[model samples]
Target: MRTDDSGALDLSDGDPILAVETLLLTRDGRPGGWRRAIHRADDFKYVFASNR
Candidate 1:
């Protein structure tokens, strides 16, 4: 979760940001891993369905 530049949070008409990070060690015993992402909340729509 994140706040606006001015340090404010408002769901309505507010920009949403997403951030993720990953770290791992290779078989050779080397540490290396990093990931970052940011996007608006209403940028895209997602749908999920399931049947049982």
Candidate 2:
């Protein structure tokens, strides 16, 4: 993920920061590859589905 200039998380105030327990990279619904979780502070979380 991306971080702001202040060194804090770039996510919004109300956004939930997922720990990225697992990552599945694929072109379609099928799993193409897997990525291990990296415990980096600079890493930002991403939400695929939004309630809004």
Taken over the whole model, the C-alpha lDDT of each candidate is: 0.54, 0.51
- Worst 10 contiguous positions by lDDT, candidate 1: 5-14
List, residue by residue over 7-48, the lDDT tens digit for candidate 1. 443444445544445677789979866655545555656677
Number of colliding residue pairs in model 1: 0
After superposition on all CA atoms, how large is the RMSD of candidate 1?
6.1
Stretches > 4 Å off in candidate 1 = 1-14, 28-30, 44-52
Candidate 1 TM-score versus the reference: 0.33
TM-score (C-alpha) between model 2 and the true structure: 0.27
Model 2 deviation from the true structure expressed as Cα RMSD, one decimal place: 9.3
| Native-referenced Cα lDDT, model 2 | 0.51
lDDT of 2 by residue, 9-31 (tens): 44554454444455575677777
Model 2 worst lDDT run, 10 consecutive residues: 5-14
